[model samples]
Target: MPRETPMDQPLISPAQRAVADAFERMFELSRAQPAPDLAARLDRLSRLRALVQDNESRFEAAISADFGHRSQVETAIAETLFVLVEIKHATKHLKKWMAPRRVATALQFMPAKNRLIPQPLGVVGIISPWNYPLQLTLAPAIGALAAGNRVMIKPSELVPRFSALLQELIAAKFDAGEITVTGIEDEIAKSFASLPFDHLIFTGSTRIGRLVAEAAGRNLTPLTLELGGKSPVIIDRSADLDEAAARVAYAKLLNAGQTCIAPDYVLLPEGKVQEFADKLDGRMRGMYGTNPDNSDYTSIVSDRHYARLEALAADAAAKGAKIVQLAKPDDPAWKAKRKFPPTLVVGATPDMTIMQEEIFGPLLPIVGCKDAGEALSWINRHDRPLALYWFGKDAAARDEVLARTVSGGVTINDCLFHFTQVNQPMGGIGASGTGAYHGEWGFNNLSKLKPVFYRSPFNRLADLYPPYGTKIARLQKMLRFMS
Candidate 1:
């Protein structure tokens, strides 16, 4: 097998001086209209399909080239098909999502009608991550479009090829001011954070999230931070061991464990840690093979990430944790491929770097817990993850974990399954994310609620006017105290 390699650096330099003048004036144009141009939006979506619909294989190849090992089927299935689905979903329910909702009218305002109108926030900035580039970027764009806001997107420079493809697609399909892909300078990312866009959505590490949030705050811009934490998967004694092993393997190893929602660590029942580890080892070999270079298993996104994982593994090893090599480190011939083995560390202490950090790689760590209760305590000690998975036959066990722990979402008996449901909310709590989007929730995230109160044209109820007398005051007091 050949040595793995990192993703190639961008051929196009991120603009240090972005064309802010055009973007600023575009913002002005948006403010003048203040309404979504749905017709223009439909045209763009139509063209998006035309641009890539027949060229699906090429898009998949572009992503695989960017990542060095993005599974072809998953790339097409996850990135392209999923975005297409989002487009269709947005197109169908967009009108309803944009419609004003009726609210209950109070007795004092009986002759008046109240509506909660969904309005578009002006311009939005989306900072997309390299992992799942197309899905993350396009999916959010769909939501923003449905919400009635024009947008500016900053695709992660890490996945340069895919980012380039997106820029080309947008430039050819839409007007630049409406939705242009600005390549972010390492500093431009921070500058974008400082912009006062009505809304910003960033998907990346919690470390960067802090900087983005702080910068966004300076300008009073609201943001949705899709940050990361160590998501955990627990294997209960009542669980089907084989099935649990398979699912856990799939969750953490998919996208080479680069998913923000990936299972960062695992809590296995005592006395079964070795068995689980052995099973996982064999399963990974079956999936990616004992040889990573030739295996369908993906490579790490970049050397920086590979080194981060290597340091974590080294740190854990130095601390006396047992290293379980599912596949030894990739061959040097594939060194430029950014390849690493699907490794696991056993007896991982809570203090280890691998346990503390989001292991966004093929490395998996197993910590032996006394029981499900102990597992919950272990997880409760850390920042809440975007997701949590517990496998068991006991209904009470499932409920206990769900009731005791706090996470963005939980998928009992399965891992990373929640994100597949397009209708479910996909943000975090505590640190993972504040808002969510996928289906209706995604549409809601990018929209604003503007309520309108209408008084009946022939209203004869003048009891609550400004010239209030004792009678009106008494009646108001009665209503206020009544319920």
Candidate 2:
């Protein structure tokens, strides 16, 4: 017989306590032992790689279950393969990244040498969203581990199936003190954010990011927020309509437009709105087909999310925007399966609700601008976006957009490709997000690069330290002249 637990005690405390215990153990170990050496870090990376490779099918299945019907190919490309690339990149570069860097000494301190040494922050906490659960959660963990910090993750409750599968798989490969995933209970998330982690990384909407920032702030925890905003696409007169339309349509429709960096709206020449919309509609239909049951298309995550997308379309319609649904949105088959039809809102104005918020679903609005200058002004007026896409052939026009606007990242003549570059840092600016992490940027972000200086015994710098003599005044005069 088992002893009964107290009914009045918080039911979620056990789950929260388990996470807290894991953090404590990891933190203590980080303090006691020197950061894991190169070989140990490599071993961890190898295990992580094997964990995904061996369980790829299961992960795809679980994520599909979470999304009602997530495309298997999308999972492979976006989630699993992406993580593998990150791990491989980090493994290949870890030694050079770990080595201390030489710093130039000042002329006055020429005899002394300076070095910047990278060391781990004790433990890192990751709060990941559901849209790309595996990729977002593990990408930062890869960076933290490469930098020699222990990791703890709290995945979104919306993807409970994937979250549970991740928790089990990670535990099998890693020690609790090395890396661990926590439960997705409401209380656990509340408790998880409040932990005094050495650093925190959150990927989600800006609204929730504020709450996480507030919690992390109380503990003075440094944070990397990967929040989303209304990322825009500019279609210049020089761009080929058919080519641009196909690329943008594919990008916008991927995972039902759940991606943070997906183009929120398109700005094209004033008169071409309808022409471009027809081209986009054709491309979207060609790729995903008219049936919502197409395996290539993914379902919206839940009924609530489905309804939200519908309301956005309806709201835009009410505001005099023409709503173009690729398939019938009211079809019982689509709604029963939680699939949201690909939609375009034409003649979208600034006053409409669709243009006001980050449209996280498969709804896109096409707004027209008088010229490149007007397009630039429109983007600058809002919160900086996480990503921007420009479609055109004119070098001067593209350069103008690049020079005038601010965004987390940009891709020319395409969408979502800049983020795939391992050499580039992935992050956002302003409300879109703050801080970047990818490849070496990630290793550097999670590290404490302490500067050390070696002093020469024969140097006369000590003579000017305390005594207010004539010699000190002469030295100070020379320093001022150098400054």
Candidate 3:
């Protein structure tokens, strides 16, 4: 028997109730209007693009305020421009994606045509995270809108200013029945998850993903969870050390290493650990300077997250890990700004807290491996990550790693570039996440590829319809033989 969600119990506030009512109204409106033409979808996408473009400075400031010191360049590239690119991609290819695909009719059903129609899933719920709040929220919304479905977005409560601003922007550009944005506290988030949306998308931690999965499960709602794990970077012997270090440093330090697909740890060639660490340190220092306050580095999102990251580093150091701070550790100004310097943790073990969890901060653990096989074995030993980055020129080694490891996505000789490709699907496999969304994949995921069959007026199945007789048995035998 299925467990029931108690409806009589009031788990949400009046404001949350209003949001829920809005969702119900939007869902009904989506059903009544059913399929939206390409022109309507394009118009929605255009409005969304205009919304981001018009409020670029506001978005930058809001995100910067939320993060304490997020660089405008980073916001433009990662958040605003990223979404704009997605909109452009969707707009350019929506017609092809929406076209009904013809399927071959089997011999058993000769003369009957079959086609798969990509239809909207009515109402979709998007629950975005705070790390890249604007991009995460709007990217999926782009897909949902392109697929002609109504959307209700729940921005993370962690970034209150950004969430409020996003709500205002979305409300101004779209009708509530078409696209709506709301911010909810923890209790309301639970209620929001429990709603019977046609599809739900969540981007956040693996732990919370489990709860979201459970709630969505009760309603049998399909979900696309963009959860995070300890994404690993493998440094092959044939790799360029300096180049690898620079790419890894940029990815790990971007958004203060708070990115979901950021290289959580590096598996370096055993004997070259120090050399690789040195190159990485140089890259970090060059990128952000010796003083974190003097650079375009971002701070941790909140004091709680800051304390948690500090605790993880402290726990690892206490457990015999060699901590190497790349920048000046005792800088009072950097400390005051809550800007943690990029650090490298040597001698990380499986039992250490830093190794056990996703290090969504400026700490990179360097694990030594003798060869490519050892590195592959180490990655296989843990849950699949959101991404796996391999930096080397060896074709065989790269292909071997690709064949052996399972992850949401991968980038060769670079980090996080796989995510930038609009054609490819970005998502996880086992634990990191479920389903995928990006490009046409995102549109398809939000839509139901409903199979349609056009039966001919000249029917041939009447002989096998009702009578359980010798003729029917013979027909079945002949069909089985043909099959």
Where does model 1 exceed 4 Å of error?
Answer: 1-17, 333-336, 457-467
| Candidate 2 per-residue C-alpha lDDT over 1-483 given as tens digits, one digit per residue, 9 for 90 to 100 | 642222322546777777777777787798899989999999999999999999999999999999999999999999999999999999999999999999998877768899999999989999999999999999999999999999999999999999999999999999988999999989888878778789999999999999999998977889999999999999999999999999999899889999999999999999999999999999998998888779999999988988888888988899899999877677998998888999999999998889999998889999998988899999999999999999999999999999999999999999999999999999998898888899999999999999999998877788687757788988888788877
lDDT (Cα, tens digit) per residue for candidate 3, span 174-289: 98899998766776787888888899999999999999999989889999999999999999999999999999999999999999999999997889999999899889888988
Each model's lDDT comes to 0.79, 0.91, 0.89
Looking at model 1, residue 391 earns an lDDT score of: 88
What are the per-model C-alpha RMSD values against the true structure?
Answer: 6.8, 4.1, 2.2
Q: Alpha carbon lDDT of residue 138, candidate 2?
A: 91
Off by over 4 Å in 3: 1-11, 328-330, 468-474
> lDDT by residue for model 1 over 448-479, one digit each (tens)?
88778898866545666767778687776867
By the lDDT metric, which is better: model 1 or model 3? 3
Collision count of model 3: 0
Model 2's alpha-carbon lDDT is: 0.91
Q: Can you give the TM-score per candidate against the true fold?
A: 0.92, 0.96, 0.96
Backbone clash count for every predicted candidate, in the order shown:
14, 0, 0
Q: Order the candidates by lDDT, highest first.
A: 2, 3, 1
**Candidate 1 Cα deviation (angstroms), residue 94:** 1.5
- Tell me the lDDT of model 1 at 32: 91
The numbered model that scores best in lDDT is 2
